[model samples]
Target: MKIRVTGAFLFNVLCTISYTCCGETVGKRPPHIVMIIADDMGSNDLSYRGLDQITTANLDAMGFNGIIFNRHYTEPICTPSRAALLTGQYPIRLGLQGEPISAGEDRHLPPDVQTLPQLLKELGYTTHLVGKWHLGTARREDIPKGRGFDTHYGYWNGYIGYFDYETKSAMTITSEVYEGFDMKENFVDAWKDKGIYATHIFTEKALDIIDAQNKDIPMFLMVGHLAVHTGKNGMVEVADEKTMNNTYGYIADLERRRYVDALMNLDDSVGRIVEKLQQRDLLQNSVVIFMSDNGAQIRGIFHNGGSNYPLRGEKFSHHDGGIKNAALLYSPLLEKKNYIHDHLIHITDWLPTLYSLAGGNITSLKKTDGVDQWLSISQNKPSKRKNILINIDEVKLYSGVIGYGGRYKLLNGTIQSGFYDSFTGEPQSSNKMDYDIAAILNSRVNKAIKKSKVPGKHLDEALIRNLRKSSSAIRNNSKCNRGTEKYEICHHFCLFDLWTDPCETENLIRQKSKDDIVLNLKNQLAEFWNEVSPQTNKPVDINSDPAKYNGTWCTWLDDEFCIKIKTNNQNKNCNENNRSTSSIPVLKL
Candidate 1:
């Protein structure tokens, strides 16, 4: 026997030896990560998702080229969802699940929590955050740069004017666009009257960041776009007249027209970012995640013209439309593409998932509500997360939780009766519900074991039986215990099988053989709540006291700019006297 090593073979051998010696395969580099979050975008907002009125060519292409998550869920509002994504914990745990953080409020996301950027930074990745940072800006320590980002740009308020970037409160009003390398020392206002659109400015800076970053180290850029969200002072503006005129071409209704224009501009931003990545020859080596903080604000009195069609309820509710969001993951690194993965995913999960993709160990991280689903996502394998606690709206005392052990799902507290295909955005027939659920669950589990390198079997016969029985118990044991109220029989819960009824239109509370399921779920809810800490909403001192605004952007609290600005006047249409009188539903969890 003779062995011969050619020049090419020796080169390959040397490369392999170098990798084993230094953990690098010749010139290979880590993938860059970009996360683009759209504000107040709904499930059906994009044309690709069946919105007849809106055109989102770029987002549509993202979904078509990457993977679309048809059933991803988030909190019913922005601040909570962002906190969950950043901290990898439910908002309830961080005392951020209530109303959004107002401009002058002293409350903020706890600085001690380990954020996604902080983890990435520890992994030698440079991180930048552009656009809305609603979690909190009441203090310097609570801002993005303080929370692990290397560079921070954009507003610190809940929402700001598209052009002015000003946010108003009862006491003061100030434009809140600033940029800095460090929040504690170098923070300074970046845009006040730049004449550039918010969406466009954010994108321009994002491209600049990409261009300026060191290519040798991986980068994580989070563009938290303030598109399609109505401004705090009731302002609704979009691209300039010329841009609107040339692009959208005369949308009839004023509010709706501006909305479409805003959405279109957002699409343009995404297109520009992708184009920049392609131009830099980084498209194939980058992973871009596009998602909404929550579903679209479709039913507010001053509607933003965003749609969550085919799914019941809107923002601030417990239905699919409110919690379920439009989401997509794009990357050439993915084993599969151009497909929809119908798995249960929570906003908190992104921290662990993205961290794992960046080569971090999931088990070594602090405890969080999120489960690392990198394999399930990139490989199109079965999800390790089979269940999710949708939301616990303390205001309404309503909670929606999913138990995906078997085909059965508990809505408020009962079992679901029908089927709704989240992938197709359509309801299914009740007759084929059981068979369909079992088949899909089985196939995904088998594929995960055979093809994916991850370990976990979320669906098994024994687990399904136990989960089903528990859900039935909860429903049956629920009794009428009204305190200082009318003595009436109320189930206090609603049930739906997400596999069969993703729309959550049909309630199975009236169905038989569901007592055990309800009781178990109720018990589980109690346990989950045990981990949720209470929120402390520190009051904003908007009075003419300069001392009160020391740490916050509320220095303008005494300023009457809210009355002086013409844009504020233009927003009078959404004022208290002229606002829509349409009623928003208080969802039954």
Candidate 2:
């Protein structure tokens, strides 16, 4: 006799199958995830990467003990990179691949997309955001709280003043600048935090959350630091005056010295957070991630004196220096550690990777450009990803299209008026002051390693020396012969073997042997561009100006005049054929 199968029985069978595919056994407690993101950090800014100008002992320790993703990539700018991380899909799919969201613009991450935090929340995790939320804020549903974060304690716009917590935007029509307080604590003005430095305040809030978190339920905390990014006036903010003047006084460039101070404060925040995790007994069951949103802006808007030396291009370009970033993962759950992973990985892979690690069903997620790399990351297996569509932007001028497959990368456009096509940043120089890496290992690394209970491993001077040697070997092997040319132009098309010429130093379009590779990558780029969504960027809304909202940048779509202005703009666009463009009315004081 045949057994009857009902819908409920089929659903149960599918769930079991999906769970098995997730690579995690049922009934196991999911690991806590703590993600720390730095804004506008350079590719070679860290001390562990052989940059002798600045020291990042805490971050260096993490790299020394964790898996360093040498080929990890992100978008060339802030909004796109954050969108890819949160949704596990390319920003082009959500129309966010254009320029970053301005203070009063109407663009934001689409409301219907399920975010990483939302998925974790379904698996019994408490999600919190403790820093920048640059996706969107024009609508109430676009804020962090509305997008699955249980609580948000930071600024809603892009970068803000470290001490004053203010955002300034100039009107499109008249170029009139408007300034306002941008900090908020879960949808209200956090005026009390105005005078406090952002890094210190954000770190304290994270520590508090960790201290008060429920032990039974898993937690997901994201610390989006404002360090290394320039303040409201396009100047680097110094966190410690004495440190800059005395410790880093040897650096002739004052701007670079200020930036180094800011980075040190960020490093201090990392150390404190890790120490808290160990104290709270969360170290053994937690996965910690540290990364930058994108490459640094060496010279431009929001310039912070950052350097991506030895790599070409800056923040807004598609070059390796612009999109390639330094990232590492640390946890006791990994079977692999202390090695540089050279396989290709993209920012979009985090959504499915993290979800699978959280014991969620990956088959349930909608069609995404990202693929699960949990096994590849945790088990040291070869990456399942073969190609990455860097970006395809049609709205912004000089914004290019890029694609990577196998060992080759293709680019068809330029960025920043093609001014940053060469290597940018400070010259490689010797250290003026010596820092003790052994002290950090003894004080910070050994304690955490002992608590983590991973067997047969001890961090010491020999281990660190070995790690530095291996890392240097990887870096040296990837370097190609630098061309004597001053600048490499890519106005039409350019091809380079990323495995050999990681710096984009030589364009191989002239080689006859690489025709097949170039054609294949070009075809892939075309397919990605075909699925591009119309960019959602809108003109600056003067009605959303902070001057009208009690001197704070806020959601103004609820106000009567704001709604009326939106309607008026819509009507004006509809009747443009009968009216002159200059007839539009300006905002009245």
Candidate 3:
């Protein structure tokens, strides 16, 4: 009799497993999603990440309630990060080896690659993007509505003096600067510009969108904020340690009070969104996510704006400081709280995860570089990546290298360009030197060169297909030569924990690893490189004349190309100055 009862119980469990395997997952119910991204906020910039000086209470609250991923990652910079997130494909795969659109032009997502939003929209979910949209130029592809999103609002360019109405007005005509595109352009001029602050206005607009979307259909809102990207003009001047000024830094400078103000405004934006969810009684049903595009720039006059603490380097460089950021998953479906899920998730993973939760049929969807983490999360399974990959400006690796397996975050840059740590207030230093790396830096004779012939990894057919689609969308139809690119090689060492050094300050790349481990990592890196090296690099399209500034402040020393940006100003009609209207309604959250 006892055996018969036990057999009956086993039979019931098997039946349940059969139902799930047949695709009737869980209760077979879909979940709603909201993904919020912050621009240029470093991995440790927020209070939630344990910053003592800053206050991000609301985000902290969210962190407590949701599962925080300590190892969330993004591409080294803005555009490529966004591109990766949108297409679930690698930037190199899409041939976007650098910044998204060129200086003064428009680029579109290749029509072939299917973006996350388009997939959700097809599944009957409403989609919207508010705040910074730098993945491509909206100049001609002006309306993102043409892409995957159902609604969109934000700047087309990377940075604008946040509060500079004049510059904003100028952008509508030409992408040039005025006498001032400074954050103080308003306060420095705001005393006269009347009432306008980009931070305040953009937040208002987001909330408005959220409030109006409270109807019956499920939704997907990609809220990318420019709060911390840059204030304007450039990074704020370090007036002094006690009084930090705002040129418009992402986190804030030393002026802890005002920094708190800017931080509060961002929190206010989040709080309002939370309130909307509660008011609509949708808090429990909605899945909220937040992250940053890349590491914050932590050097020079812009030094004090914010810090990534222990992480090395800043935005644009491939370092932990530049590539790491906060990531979270908030769902009422979870039975746990105050948990830290120590796993690695890349920016490109958003599409598939959200699509699956939203009841979207992703099987028929186009290819993506990101793996669906939903199954792992709900079941508490292990991570998909046993090996992680990284690429910075002019860096490369080889394939089948052994020790590269397991978990690691690779950092690559020549000795001269070590990463800067804002909290430590210094550029990282090493006692020893790579004789090979130093040799390349020691000379500059154009005629004497040794061609490197190491083979890199090759992409699988599926990854190649989606990458091509994403690249074609943004590049339109342009052929680019990638022969000019160069990359430095380094072990995938994010911040190593050395055995001999108790303080753990040493980098394990050359110090602690066994010779065999190093060889293996090299091989794995080579495999990744082979797969990505053949890809096309980014395209630049500046409409200005380079000859205009033979030797002037208009020129920036780009390693590969001396980027010369000359301003061309034109007068607006007299009617424009006098014409005015009431404030446009701002969308909340």
Across 412-472, the per-residue lDDT of candidate 2 in tens digits comes to 8786557666776444433554545665575454466667676546667777777766654
Give the per-residue lDDT digits (tens) of candidate 1, residues 486-568: 22111367776555554554567666786777677777777776766777565554442222222225324324321221354
Candidate 2, residue 64: Cα displacement in angstroms equals: 1.5
Residue 461, candidate 1: C-alpha displacement in angstroms? 41
Model 3, 1-589: lDDT tens per residue?
3544332343334334422311435332334577777766656555544444444545654554456676667876777788788888877666565544533334545667778877766656678877666555423333355567766665544664444422221233454432312121100112232234566656666667778874455667777776675544454212122332332234323333333455556665676666566555555557778787787666542332555655545665554566666666656655443456555667777777776666544575667767677655554556675555554333333111111222443343322344342123321222211222221122121001111111222223343233223312311212111123222233344333211221123445665545455556666666666666343333333332222322111112221232232334312221123223224321121
Backbone clash total, candidate 2: 0
CA lDDT of every candidate? 0.63, 0.78, 0.49
Count of clashes in candidate 1: 28
TM-score of each: 0.73, 0.89, 0.67
**Superposed model 2: Cα runs more than 4 Å off:** 1-21, 24-27, 397-406, 425-435, 443-446, 474-484, 560-589
User: Candidate 3 — which residues are off by over 4 angstroms?
Assistant: 1-29, 100-102, 106-108, 165-195, 236-259, 300-304, 361-365, 392-406, 412-416, 419-504, 511-513, 533-571, 582-589
Q: Give the candidates in order of lDDT, highest first.
A: 2, 1, 3
